[model samples]
Target: TKPKSRSLCMANPSAYNYTTDIFTAAALRWLETGRTASKPFFLYLSYTVPHAGGWGSWPRAPEDGNPVPSDLQYAAELSWPEVERDHAASVSYLDARIGEILRELERLELSSNTV
Candidate 1:
């Protein structure tokens, strides 16, 4: 098996600032460099926000109201819950990044080839 590599970022509030993470960025880079319709590529993408600091595992999470910081411009004037506002921002950021990947795939003519 390949060695497990990890990027350690403080999971606490506002620790994350960048819109795209190393994994996603790397995937996009790979897609950008050499994308072919004949070759099959698999990406196992996972995210932390909206899942981490979520209250499902423990009820106290929501009660504690741990406010997190998101992209300054993206997070400004939001209509979501205080604690989960960061989650919303995080999701949006991720969505935008994914959109970039999708656009690259389309540009490379790999969109129709991908599952």
Candidate 2:
């Protein structure tokens, strides 16, 4: 069945460290759930790597109480400041995830249609 309209679900802000399931699942749902096939659709993703508010973000601290992965891309360099390296690692991790999403969109043939 086709959906009459698109929808949004607002999650209560919490310190939960959700994994890629948070992102990939939503994209899969939008693509496979018949919500936007053969019609115009829009998605808004405000990534949180740069967001200062942890409680208001999706990828908060791990809901399972585990520490966030260092996501280090520069671990080979032992001379850099920890804070700077960690921050870069986080951004690098995010970029890779975004790339995955983009590749998925292309696999679905939705890349040209997406903004």
Candidate 3:
């Protein structure tokens, strides 16, 4: 197996910002100010979640490699184990990011033209 790469920002506060948040913000920013309406624009966005070791699992305890941001989106799942709750939270976070992007598209009048 190939060695997993680690994030250089693992120790930074921004490291906990989460991949979905970062990508969604970038997508929104581009849609708002970085694009030209005179020509077609192509944006490719991919999110990492419901996957192993987010940010290379930096937010997790040293012994736990599967990590999610320390967010409470699933904190109400008291019956679930912490790891499972974290996973569920991450998935929900991804869904929210997608919704944000879609909303931005609609706001920008790009949904019908976008694929």
Candidate 4:
């Protein structure tokens, strides 16, 4: 079945920022609602980083200076020198957010009983 929310930002190759935003939000929600006494909660927090069309794809004209027209920014046409750097940064941002959630779990003493 198709997803109910087209909210999967990872599908947008140019929007790693969007993917990170979604991951963090979901992690927060999972932490809030996933505590139970009898069963271990399983969270599947999938991230769409280093996906297609992200900063990992190509460097567009700067949004503030000498910006190219929107119509001219093609992923197939541009060569970005820092694609790996951009991907790494995106991954790091999401990792940090996950760390925050794990820290909260530890603080609440949920790791021992619930994991």
Greater TM-score among 2 and 4 belongs to 2
Which tens-of-lDDT digit does each residue in 1-115 have in candidate 1?
2223223442322433442565566787788877689987776667555565653231222333644344345334433445465666667878887888888788888887765
The candidate that achieves the highest lDDT relative to the unseen native structure = 3
As for TM-score, the candidate ahead, 3 or 4, is 3
| Global lDDT of each candidate | 0.60, 0.54, 0.64, 0.62
Q: Which should have the higher TM-score, number 2 or number 3? A: 3
TM-score, prediction 2: 0.52
Task: List RMSD in Å for every model shown.
Answer: 9.8, 12.3, 10.3, 11.4
User: Residue 18 deviation, candidate 3, in Å?
Assistant: 1.5
Question: Which candidate would rank higher by lDDT, 2 or 3?
Answer: 3
Model 2: residues >4 Å from true position, as ranges? Answer: 1-21, 35-37, 53-78
What RMSD does model 3 have? 10.3
Query: For model 1, what is the C-alpha lDDT against the true structure?
Result: 0.60
Best by TM-score: 3
The TM-score measured for candidate 4 stands at: 0.51
Cα error, candidate 2, residue 14 (Å): 16
lDDT against true structure, model 2: 0.54
Ranking by TM-score: 3, 1, 2, 4
Encode model 3's per-residue lDDT on 29-109: one tens digit a residue: 889985554557677987867675533333333233444337746534334455655776788889988899889877777
Candidate 2 lDDT over 1-115, as tens digits, reads 3233311232322322433436645666666665433465677766656444323333333444544447745335334444555666677777887787777677776766643
